[model samples]
Target: MAKDQTTRICCIGAGYVGTCTSAVLAYKNPSVRITVVDTSEAKIGAWRSRSFPISEPCLQEILKQVVERLAFSTDIEAAINAADLIFICVDTPTVTKGTGEGFALDTSAVVACVAKIVEVSTSDKIIVPCGTADQLRKLITQKNTKGLNFEVLSNPEFLAEGTAIHDLLHPDRVIIGAENTPKGSNAAARLVSLYQAWIPSDRIKTTNTWSSELGKLAANAMLAQRISSINSLTAICESVGADIQDISQIVGLDHRIGPHMLQASIGFGGSCFEKDIRCLVYLAESLGFRHIARYWMADLEMNDFQKASQTERITSLLGPLASSKLTIAVLGFSFKAGTTDVRSTPVLTIVRDLVGRGHKVKIFDPKAKKEDIQETLCKANLGRERAIVSLNAMQACDGAHVIAIATAWDEFRTRPGLRRMDWKSIADGMQQPRLMFDGCNVVDAKYLEGLGMKVLELGRKQAML
Candidate 1:
């Protein structure tokens, strides 16, 4: 295929990674015709409508512009037959049973997709896997026989949730892994050319097949490790009465250390970090490196501790949440800002614990859908009177004794150093001793005090922080 030639691309899974990646490809490259196929008819229907399956900012707007170029369908076989390239962006979740339970990646989805491809596809096509599961390569090799030719390429995504569009437009780096042979080089170049339309040539990195798979796991593990390291220090700072902000500044000033992903909060929560780190641990253990596996495993343990400790700290502050009968609110429910994905969110654990403690809870998010929020909490009463989903920030904090700013959303904070709340209204809505817990440090404590709310931040005992 030539550099400027139009290509038919079929993405097997239409999820957070698949949908965003395919949307960007279609928008940036008019030469590229993209079809996203998912097994769930409901998801395909949502994608076809103005309302997206995922609540992402500007997603529906962009979908409207690129609707002609992009197609969402449940017809997997037909989409596959018309494609020159197949992108497998299926979910590789943590294994729950059988061999390597809890740490190994479940590659059954990708394997099943490959089987479907073998049954329908008559021509050879380049298959690029975004998930780094080991079983994919073996399945491809075993399935490859007479009258069948498929090339496996690894192209893992490092896209963050909130800034997905921007990241795709100007990626920090693009990784493509193929064999070092001539055929592999040509296949890799085809993908590089597609990205070269928007990304700089130098930013795209090419490697051998195995290196690419290992690199994907290493990248997520390192990011999770940074969060765990900073969180571990936050505990020390809290006990010593030293501010976490001071520690972060002084420690981050180092030229080698730098300042990125070092923000100390409740913990790191998303689809990738914890799952990928545990995958790394499993890989190490399978290789017989027991010590190495345990070393990296501590990060996940520390993250879980951070969430539990945060809940404990808040319950202790209220003292008998059941008898107090307070209406508490959480500002954000999604794993992070900008996307409506609730997988592995720290706020869910906190919310479940609060409900168990007999505290009335309310919630609101700028972009999160009501369905996703309810699913994560696993409570139907949340939509009812038990813990209502508020319309806005003001409504969420209207009748709560304590407000928890769980996710770091821009609207919840005092922007441009300006207060945006009715102090008297907030004060009158709640019972005695109105408290605010700043989980993500988005709210300004002193500024909230001016608005007639007592703010308590994590990792800081006094107002000095």
Candidate 2:
């Protein structure tokens, strides 16, 4: 593969992964023309807009650098036709219905993209499953491609939502899975050459198709398991009146464990962790690894218990939920900070539990859109009436007996205005004595207590005074 060759690259689905990966690739490889295609015109338009849909610190600068080279469009066919390499970065959301309901990937869009490639492509194109498993790609290729000849490769992404651009620019490794066939090997090499512009050759790992697909799931499962493990410790820590953060710090100091996903919170909440773990468990069950499935299933069980435990604590703090319509202010809806993504947020679980127990909830998030919160809550079976969305933190906290910080958004921690407006002001404006539940432990419990509010913190004992 020539470095200066006009290799056209098309990535289907201008999502968090696709947009970040395409922008970085175009930034790194100036010779390549990267076109990102998505079904949602709004998403594509956002990619082309001044404020990108997703918020990453260096993403906008990188996108600006490759603005000329990178393109976002809804014209999937045209992008596919003009491409040497087509990356199917479409969503493989967990199946909500049918055989593998609530666990398996809904590969309808991926299959559709593959079928479209088979139907429209004029030349020998290299098709890469950019966001999914190699098994899915093989299944799609086998089912859709009869006469069509295309090289299908697996190039799964491991970019975290808030820090996607950074992850893409400096990835740990670029794993490319290719078949033993000449076309497959050529396709893998072509993909590798593009990454080699920025990434060193040593970091580019090559393996058989199955390993590559399974590796993505395995990595996520392991990460989620770590979170679950720490969360499991949180329950024990609370029971024993021990500090989980201190324990985590000590545990992380060990060379064997190290520090990564050791921060304990309400629970693990993201699109990947829970979904991938569920998929892995399902995959194990399907393969007759019942014991293995049960083992992995415990991770998910622990996660659910972790989140549910918070809700139970909230109820315990509030007391007599049936007797009162509790006005609870929830800060931060996104799973984590620095991004507007609300998929599988722990806040939803808290909100649902509160609402189910006849509590009135008012939610506020700095980055999350009102529609996203409404949609997420509705999907969780808690509606708009049950959960009121507020634009500002003050408004969300207004007249509320309790303020719960579900996400560790930077704004929630460092904003002086929020800190200065202490419990006295909040209590004076509320129906009852104010309470603050720091689910993320972003606030100072003593400071809040000084202002005459009850402070409940995760991973730390509540001050008896």
User: Which model scores highest in lDDT?
Assistant: 2
Q: In model 1, which residue pairs have backbone atoms overlapping below 3 Å?
A: none
lDDT of 2 by residue, 1-465 (tens): 343354799999888788888888898888889999998988878777765777777888888788889999999889998988888888788999998888887778888888788778776678887445455556556655456567788888898887888888889999999888876777788888889999999999998878898899999999988888888887677778999889989999999999899988888888888888888888898899999999998998888898888877766656654358888999989998877899888778888888887888999998888888888887787877879999888788888888889998766663456553444566566556577888887887776667667888887765332
Number of backbone collisions per candidate, in order?
0, 0
- Candidate 2 displacement at residue 358 in angstroms: 1.1
RMSD of each: 2.8, 2.6
The TM-score of candidate 1 is 0.92
User: In model 2, how large is the Cα lDDT of residue 435?
Assistant: 78
Relative to the unseen true structure, what is the C-alpha lDDT of residue 402 in candidate 2, on a scale of 0 to 100?
81
What overall lDDT goes with each candidate model? 0.80, 0.82
- In candidate 1, what are the lDDT values of residues 1-465, reduced to their tens digit? 443343999999988889988998998888779999999998888888755666655566677778889999999999998888899988889999999899998988888988788778878778887555346667767776646667778898888887887788889899999978776788888888889888999999999877888898899999888888888877677677887877878888998999888788888888899988989999999999999999999989999999888877776766655366678888898887676777888887788777777777898887787767777666434335566677887788886888888888776776555445555576678765688888887766776788677777877774321
